[model samples]
Target: MQRSRDGRCKCLSKVGLSWKGSVDEDVVELVQPLTGREQFFTASSCAGCIILLDGGINGFEVQKQNRCWLLVTHKLYVKDDVIVALKKANGGAVLKFEPLVLHVQRQQLQDAQILHSVAIDSAFRNSGIIVGKRGKTVLAVQSTHGLEVPLSHKGKLMVTEEYTDFLLKISKSKNGGKQEEN
Candidate 1:
């Protein structure tokens, strides 16, 4: 689980937004316009996950960090320059890129459906949008493709580069087309 400050995320505070850290930079860029319409609010998110352990492939050791979320978002439009600041803040703690996952709270089933449609349209590929208690709908959106590797190895940064490029390419490809527009 990621850390939250007074029921808010510290990441949100660093960017000079509201105290709640419901959304991070990358997500803000991806969903700012929708948020402005008050259709939904993000509860928590994991842009990706990373874990660091002391063991290699041969054996096992203590896990330094277990399932840490790289980014979390809410509703504020606090952009940290495309998550560059968050990455920089991560320092050398990150070890892998897990699938992007988001938990969102929507106003209605229609809003959730709209978000689900947008998420699938954006190539997320794996989304579990369900109606929770009290008319609140939650969406768990995840990406099928991601980079997973130990940072101890050399050239790992190259893998990160490649992964980032891949995500951008797919996102752009999905956004540039009108498959459902006819």
Candidate 2:
């Protein structure tokens, strides 16, 4: 048998959890279970995080104001884990919370569809699918729960815990089910 030129292991490369940089523990714990399965793999992910920048969008330059992913995950995951990950957000130039965002790569279209259904069940909305550069079908999963607050207010964080909690409640209520008018 002729050996293949590609050195990467097909089995391991397409069926494991991977990250671009450091990730939150909560996210890791949440994703670990999925990576063990045969049909999916995580490419990049973030359990919604917060960041601050010195220069405001209004063009004011200060110290070290920049956005950072408090948490990131690149795999199939439960949307609630993103909100729960926010528990790690504390004491920084913390400005806002970005809801859980995931990029999952599936073995094929059917796999993508299955994951999409799973995402919907987990309260994730705005689910989309695309063929990756490597010819893999990838699913973009998202939760509507997120926040962007003006950190320019006296160089301090204007976002409050109450506001984030409210966003979470709204997001949870909107999960793939029917909405009720108040």
Winning model by lDDT: 2
* lDDT per residue (tens digit) for residues 1-182 in model 2: 11125532233234234344433444666665655565665666666644332233433333333543444332223235544544444433233445676777667798888888988887787678888677878788887665444332434444565554454444334332233333
State the TM-score for model 2.
0.53
- For 1-182, candidate 1 gives per-residue lDDT tens digits of 12354443233323322233456455666545544444555566554433332222333232334534444332122233223423433323233334557776566787788878888998888887877566667887877765333333221232354444343344333333222221
Clashes of each: 5, 12
Query: CA shift at 39, candidate 2, in angstroms?
Result: 2.1
State the weakest 10-residue window (summed lDDT) of model 1: 73-82
TM-score of each: 0.47, 0.53
Cα lDDT computed for each candidate against the true fold? 0.47, 0.52
Runs off by more than 4 Å, candidate 2: 1-23, 56-94, 153-182
